[model samples]
Target: MQAPMTAYKRAWGEASAKLIRKELEKVRQEGDFSEERIAAALRRLGCGRDHGVHLGHGFYSVHTGVACVSGRVAKDEVTSKVHGAYAEPQPGTGPCVENRGGH
Candidate 1:
């Protein structure tokens, strides 16, 4: 059985998706749905930032065609590669940094 919060989140996610689709349709019919315009509409619909809709990290809007992390396939090769490097520390491959002076 799913927790109440999980169920609620799923429901909300679905509703938000529907809303986005509707807005996109409106934009298409109006022939004014540029990428920026779509992004603005999404923001107005509360689909960006700290909103519940997690459209992938670094993904600000849907006009880019980048779906949310949850919307991607768990076993997708591209997703696997991206997720693999998400948290691991990156070793310095450039010139060493030395502290010169402290403010």
Candidate 2:
């Protein structure tokens, strides 16, 4: 027979999922809910995924549509942070900063 706790766990998981989905819907309605935006936010949480579909090495948040971690980072977060496929800005690829300084 299945453990009694198994049913409880399943129920909690389902309920949590529903709540998360609802929050995600709210976030989507607020503003740009694109993958890029979410990925950026996830970076702050020390989580990221390539292609915005595959879980790299951290947790992904559907509610915020962002990558997230369960708790505070314990060490050098910069080197530890994961970058999504398009998360990191390609050097010399951006049009903002340039050698063309205002003359």
Best by TM-score: 1
Give lDDT for model 1. 0.36
- Residue 101, candidate 2: Cα error in Å is 45
The residue-level lDDT of candidate 2 at 39 comes to 52
Global lDDT of each model?
A: 0.36, 0.32
Candidate 1 residue-wise lDDT at 41: 60
lDDT of 1 by residue, 1-103 (tens): 1112355445554554566666555555566534465556667776554432333232222211222222221112111111111111212211111123343
Q: What is candidate 2's TM-score against the reference? A: 0.29
lDDT of 2 by residue, 43-97 (tens): 5443334322222233233211222112111122211221112233223322111
Model 2 / residue 1 / CA error / Å: 22
For lDDT, the strongest prediction is: 1
Model 2 RMSD vs true structure: 17.4
Candidate 1 residue-wise lDDT at 64: 16
State the weakest 10-residue window (summed lDDT) of model 2: 67-76
Error of 2 at 6 (Å): 1.9
